[model samples]
Target chain A: MAEKSSELKLLSAWFSPMALRAKIALNIKGLEYENVEEDFNSKSHLLLRSNPVHKKVPVLIHGEKSICESSIIVQYIDEVWSNNNAPSILPQHAYDSAIARFWVSYIDEKLFVCAKNIQDAGKSDEEKKPHSEQLEEEMLVRLEEAFNKCSDKKPFFGGNNIGLIDIALGSFLPVLGLIEEINGRMVLVEDKFPGLINWAVNFAANPAVAGTFPEIDKLILFGKTLLKKMGYCL
Target chain B: MAEKSSELKLLSAWFSPMALRAKIALNIKGLEYENVEEDFNSKSHLLLRSNPVHKKVPVLIHGEKSICESSIIVQYIDEVWSNNNAPSILPQHAYDSAIARFWVSYIDEKLFVCAKNIQDAGKSDEEKKPHSEQLEEEMLVRLEEAFNKCSDKKPFFGGNNIGLIDIALGSFLPVLGLIEEINGRMVLVEDKFPGLINWAVNFAANPAVAGTFPEIDKLILFGKTLLKKMGYCL
Candidate 1:
């Protein structure tokens, strides 16, 4: 029963969590959209034209308007089509919304860097010794605090439904799991980050999140391939 | 005309452009707030408790609510006191607001680094060579594009009044000016960045900007002192 709504197109990459954020948000809202996977080596004209600043992926085109950056795009999508029956991504209260946005920014600013470093280090044996371990310890402590902050009452960052913060952080779960699997180590284990672990499980098990998240095996394979590319493989 | 409304207090530092952003935003909004200048060496408990995550100022304390991150605090200030007579710092339109926020983020993520490099270089002879020159070129091109993007038909980033992008970028003006003064060269000349230069002049000349910005001579002194502290100068 679609009647000429604004066309939504997402320029995404399979393994990129940033693109996964856009993907999950769209699916959660029950919005019908076309997904065009961008080649990592050669970006499309649309991607470039849409996001000339960063020229990166996860560009959401709603008719003529193209919103770049995953968090920004997610907010835009939520605002533009806000009449959805799905749970509100951003909190209703201004302060809560601010807090949500802050966490989302924090994930990008802090946690993402640590995660990337761990991923890179996992690929490299020499650097993986004590450096990655130290970062992992720091990451765990921070994530523990963050989990306590976000999961004050409920399973998710916003308490009830999968909110903005949830979407932002959850997108990286598959890759993180893959990293743990490859390294034969536990990252966000239940003991240290109980709330985060529970939230991750709930997020992964959701119907909306079903097909959106890439397979763990596929991600591990990609990670291993990257390691090989970097000339550091078993 | 100060009513017993919500108590506003800004946890700030003079040398920090980020803190300066919160100051400018509060001033532009005509919001009466207490400014608690933080000593970089010994950070106050209020700043720590208020902003537990970053533990950095400017933390805007309105009542018991503590907002951290300068840009986020600026946005919060705009939203909270939105009914004020002051022109809206953020644009009304969704897309425009996104673009405004994007440019502000750009200023932080991109321009701020180049600026820091130039500022440091200005303080030392060793860094005055090709290193700072290369950074200056990059900064000019990126900033030129940023200016063009933000300014459509008006002077300020949000067009008419000083907007989010303006506050974010303009916070560095005093520091930038001091850098130019120390180097004996103009950083943002009219010819290279006419629109930006014009905007900067208008921004500095504005009454709201006055008193909030640290004096140029004092800033230069601070820069030189910092250089000395870093052992770059005798």
Candidate 2:
């Protein structure tokens, strides 16, 4: 076993989905590391130095090297640990792996767009209603199409277990749920996307997810504050 | 040896960097394939059906499965042909692989932003001149910072080999170079970034790149026609 030292630390923010991905991956792999939470309002010099371009979290500092980008960090963890016993997150078959990666990339691109829309809506006033609704519909339509094409019999993305796809999608559920809660609108309605809703539930129920997820109340409170600061909340 | 007859087939567009990635990977690995060029303006039904969401080009159909997304396809190719004697594009060391992936991801995100700016500039009038210069400078600054920090001292992104980083960056060089050629300005001048310039030259000189690249003059003509159609050219 690799030496479990204080050297492996994760620099992250409390309510970041990207940060959660690294946390979940580490927990799933049974790796222990120190968590150094950053203040997003005023980032630290370490964070700036570690990831100068996109000085965002979560930044995984293993030994002296820093690994930014959540999805890439997860893949790195999988490679380093070789956790074959811990529910193979990535598919062994190359084609299946590609498929998993495609969905992950899609989530990175599409889901983030959706999240951005929700954030925009929260920050916008009455004049932006139509645009916000259109954005919401566009995001849902894409998700629905993806869900329809996804294998029907599979409990997870790849049929049997929670893999890379689950991790990618699962990371967003908290943010999605929080957005809906704060807005008092259901973007991912149960009837509209049963597969996605069920998947979300299953994902949330996972031990790793259940363990590391940010407290819902805390995030909701944070969202409310953010919206007010942005002059969205009345 | 793997069954040469059962090798994968790739569907690509003539002027697509994504397609070039798959093509280069195939050449690097010495894999035999049937290349069917798709018209981007009028995409084939097979391509559309294969990738409903994006409906984009550079779709690799390997036997029964279809893989879209250039980076994903390259990784898939690497995974499937793991036994091949070609140097593994992915670094063996975990930290090194992470670093390589970071650059790949950065290229996918930041470099594409610059490319989009250049493309948009080509489609704009004199009013957009400042925007184009600003975008060019932003791209150059980021590239310089990235290249400065790169671990490898070799001409390639990865040291002493053409790896994932090379493939990712190589795909974009044609478009970057063409943008400069069309604008009558050189963004990536040799004096400013000699390492990156050498890197581009080394990449262009690779047999895989030389064989598969589209004609520059033809591309410049096409780009001019495109700008004319978009009302940027008289």
Highest TM-score: give the candidate number. 1
Tens digits of per-residue lDDT for model 2, A70-187? 9888988888777546656677788878888888888888767656655664446564455456546765566556655664556667456667877877778778777778567877
Pairs of residues at least 3 apart in sequence or in different chains that clash in candidate 2? none
Which CAPRI quality tier does the interface of model 1 achieve? medium
Q: Interface RMSD for each candidate model?
A: 1.2, 0.9
**Candidate 1: tens digits of C-alpha lDDT, residues A188-210:** 77777777788888888887788
RMSD of each: 3.4, 3.4
> Candidate 1's residue-wise lDDT over B64-177, tens digit each?
888888888887877777886887888887788777777777778766765566556344666655545754676666766777877885777768788988898898787677
**Native contacts conserved, per model:** 0.21, 0.94
Model 1 segments more than 4 A misplaced:
A1-6, A121-126, A129-136, A227-234, B1-6, B120-135, B227-234
The per-model DockQ list reads 0.54, 0.81
| DockQ value for model 1 | 0.54
TM-scores of the models, in the order given: 0.90, 0.89
